[model samples]
Target: MDGSLKEEQILMSSERDWTDLPPNLIHLISQKLPDLRYFIRCGAVCKRWFSSILLSDPPPQQLPWLIEYDEQFPRASPLKEELPFYSFVTGETGSIPIQESHRGKVYHRTGHSYLLVIDGEVISLFNPLTNEEISLPQLPSRFDFIWPVFGGADPSRNWPWHISLVCDVGRSRYLTYYLDRMRWQCFDTVLHKTCNWDGMLFTTEDHGTSTLVFDAASRKELYTIPPLNEETFGFITSYFVESCGELLRVSLDYNLTRNIETYIFLIYKLNFEGGKGQPHWVKVSNIRDQIIFLDHLTGFAVRATAGLKGNCIYFFIEEHCRSDRFYNDSTLWRYDIATGTCEPVPCPFNRCSWFVPNLR
Candidate 1:
């Protein structure tokens, strides 16, 4: 306290009235603030700061908003649990309540105003921000769930949206939906996992060991990453994420049998240099000061704060326990990319999804 006061006295000694600074200078100060908490605090400091916060965007790269849920959706929220949004920059978690009218499983995030959901034949897009909704034609009777394959350089009218869903379980049959033509391309292919930023779709073979990507539009084989080196644990899984324009592969290792209390993480970046060359996995020592947010199925990466450290991964750690007495230790965790270590994070949420608050 004394040190802070001393510093303030030293600044005041200059005999300069900071509040008299022009609005442009004040705006520049707000633009330089990377953390949201400090940004909000600056707004309360004075009129100029408050105006700057409201007039400008928080930052170009905002942290992913994590939304928490229970074991399964459509379950009764006896407690009326509220969804929490955690920010990596501020190291704070803020909750936004789910309305009583809002029900059914949150299938997938479509946009800032829409979330795509499917219930049997009915497929709808609900906007929780404004409580508005728009329902499209019912999905084909064959597909059980809808998974969207997004990202690419050309996301305009050229490529609307590429989605895949399971049609037949026994035959391992699936179909891809192209929005431009309003047609479903049905085929039996590898487990259509995820896609990258360049409109290439990726899949795994040999029991989730190898990765192969192909052009979704041309239907031509692009290339494949090397086979994954298995981890010691039996419950290891891999996921592909489009991060800050680069493609990243993350391997998560955990103990399914028991809560052994440790997590292993390996992060690799695909090196693409020299225009058209063979792409290979490179062990990333740093993520260029970014953090990857991972759920079970899909994940995204964002610019991490300097205080939080870079090359680290944030995971929604689900703690599975015995006795089945309705207990779960679903805590947020941070895994260091450089040291290969894991630790508990301060933010807490049960069913959280990566979200960005509706600024609109």
Candidate 2:
């Protein structure tokens, strides 16, 4: 009792305010906080707390946004029931239905915050940040005979807002949607008429449907490449082609049994622009089987299978006959275009596909 009383009396003689604490100590508290919303609110208590906690980077343990799906291809399960997004961030898998009245599935695009959806007969672009959505009225049924391909460019780059949907209703009719002013422009490609336009729409090797592109500045038709690998219609797939980065193509190989195998692969680089610019596709990897692809950026040929949404390119590091185990533990590789390198990525599922948006 005497010792405790003496220590307390001595400490009371030399005291410090909360502001006297080091910035590191304040930062550690913010990291230990359970939620960002609460941590930010606590910082409002005083300037010392505000500046340190709100302005500085959180500790490593504070980054709670990383969501890892370790089971590559475990089984067939609905995302709503199996891997709900609500439980993903909160660690409590629950449903948070969006009340917005819209049809069609909302998917996470390459840009994490943005969503791309086809709402009913109309196409829509949404940004959850602004809590705003832009929907286009259905195109005239006259042009409904043809399918529409939609996409957006990085807004900061001044890329023209593009909507290209071809209609063979009359002569070859081309319609484009421009967002800068929110309008649609139409052009016709009749053999006798001049084809004055801005961008071109075409398909690529494994892409099931066509791709539409518009020039960023001029808002003019660029070029259209068709997805020629698949013979079926309405089977659209996405591709990513970068001028400086390696080009990767992911597709599927299906035989008469309807059993499929996934592939991840890239093509060899072939310069075709006379060394002035990027190369052009000279030959496909599997021309005979019509399973080869030529990436427009690198002009390399790759033979592989398609993924769920062009998220992965699946191919075996070592070839095996059908008699062998189909899904063996052999090393499977996924090529990252951003890194310009192809490395082995472990896959744990029997038959799974990765969903990646905006490859092209």
Q: How many residue pairs clash in all the candidates, one count each?
A: 6, 34
Give candidate 2 misplaced runs (Cα > 4 Å). 1-83, 86-112, 117-123, 135-138, 141-181, 185-202, 205-240, 243-264, 268-279, 282-360
Alpha-carbon local distance difference test for all models: 0.57, 0.36
Residue-level lDDT tens digits of model 2 in 50-163: 888756664322211111222431221212222222211134322223434532333322122223344445554544324356565555443333333333222212334444
How many clashes in candidate 2?
34
Question: Candidate 1 at residue 10, lDDT?
Answer: 88
Name the top lDDT candidate.
Answer: 1
* Residue 185 accuracy (lDDT) in model 1: 45
Error of 2 at 1 (Å): 13
Q: Give lDDT tens digits, candidate 1, residues 312-360.
A: 8887665432213322453677888777777766666556555544332
